[model samples]
Target: MRHLPVLFSAALMMASTATAAPHVVASVVPIHSIVAAVMGDKGSPELLLKGSMSEHRAVFTPDQIATLGTADLVFIVGHGLEAKLAQISGSEAVNGKTFIQLSDAPGIIKLPVREGGAWEPDDDEPAPAAGSEAEGVLAFDPHIWLDPENAKAMAREVAVDLGKADPENAAAYAANALAFAAETDKTSAAIAAELAPDKGKPFIVFHDAYHYFEKRFGLTGVGSISDVSAQAPSAERLGQVRDKIIAARATCVFREPQFDDKFVQAVIEGTGAREGVLDPLGAGLTPGPKAYDQLIGNLAESLKGCLGG
Candidate 1:
């Protein structure tokens, strides 16, 4: 009878440990980095999208599906950025799991998806008005994590969700989130200094994926070779991009590492624009707590390298 109490206490401790660690899944690399940072040493979140897979074109394998099905919480960029995962997460199959949509995270700055290859000269474009898009369709650009401020907001959201899921480790999650926010602020300040000289310096991207980052640092992306869908630009679109490149005197034409650069060469030919590579998804980066900083820093370096800063 004396040993029974100790056995019961030991069993309770094991049960508490299990409940303290939640099985969280993140939809993409950046979000995964944020979630992983917030979780700190408590646990690591499973990353859904891996390698050079385009979030738009992601198709889950059986194992990934099982991961999603079993996760206690799933963090997504939302706004249809990961449509397949979003659909699966919302479906009745995963109804029991909680989804933290970063797009809806408080203090996130949302920008409407810019139209066409050549952007308007103004950066003050307003967001879509209420009821503008079809039901369940997202009209805003979903790359909300590019801005460090937005990333800070996402960290808070992740910390809150994790705290809810693992109340026993709630204080740890909150503290880790604060540390992540401080790191992001420091990184943001350094990047701002690095990019300050390049403000209003025109550049072209392979796709229109960096508006949040551009808008954050006052960098000007005059045009994109690919449209919003990342489809190869049509001949007409390419011609327009070429014209924009020359007209804007773009210093660099940035190609994404995940895609072929042949089209980029086609656009930059005779335009005197240097070709640079930008990997917004951190395709080459190993996923971890440090990835988000590297992703943003790499972008600044790529821009500076080609922009002659």
Candidate 2:
């Protein structure tokens, strides 16, 4: 009888220790980086997508879904960024868990999907596509983490959620988020100063993914070769982008390593535009809290190298 009581006590202790920390899972690398910062030494969240894959077309395995089922809190950019996550969002696995969509976070600057016409005004009102206003559906860009300000806001949201999930470590999460936000501001200032000379300088990107970054740093994006869908622009659309590039006298055309280079090369062909690479997702970076800084820095360096910065 004495030994039985000791065994029961040991089992209870193990169970308590196992559930001491909340298990967190983030949808993508950039989001994971921010959440990791908030969690800090308290805990680490699992990254759903581990590499340079496209989040738009990412396929989740059964094991990953199972991991989501086990998470105490889940974070995603939402707005169809991780299409596969829709399945798990409503599943029983996430029934009692907290889910955060960074796109809906406060102070998030949303840019509309650029249709055939020129850059339109930024408004909460949704406008239709160029000609098919009635039939065309309104879309908002989901690449919210490209801007440091948005990232800071997202970090705050994450810290708030983490504090709720694990109240014992609430102060740590808040402190880490504050520290991260300050660092993000510092990095943003440094990047802006470095690229200030080239502010308003025109450039072309692989896709319509850098509007947040461009709008933040005062850079001008002439046009993107691809749309947000990652679909190749139609021949007429490509010609229109080419005309814009030529008209703006864009000095560089940027391509992402995740996508094929042939299209970018063909677009810039005969235009005398220098080719540069811009990786918004930080494909080559090690996924962690520090990777966000590296991603922003790399983007600035890439722009400077190609745009005479």
Number of the top-ranking candidate, with lDDT as the measure: 1
lDDT string for model 1 (25-75, tens) is 888889899999999999999999999988765778878887776677777
Q: Any runs in candidate 1 off by more than 4 Å, and if so which? A: 1-20, 92-98, 120-138
Q: What is the C-alpha RMSD of each candidate to the true structure, in Å?
A: 8.0, 8.5
Displacement of residue 184 (Cα, Å) in model 1 is 0.8
Clashing pairs in 2: none
Error of 1 at 249 (Å): 0.9
TM-score of candidate 1 against the unseen true structure: 0.87
RMSD of 1: 8.0
Per-residue alpha-carbon lDDT of candidate 2 for residues 55-170, written as tens digits (9 for 90 to 100): 76677787888777666677888765676565456555544343567787877878877765323222332333344312221368888899899999889888877776667778
How well does candidate 2 match the true structure in TM-score terms?
0.85
The alpha-carbon deviation from the true structure for residue 29 of candidate 1, after best TM-score superposition, in angstroms, is 1.1
Most TM-score-accurate candidate: 1
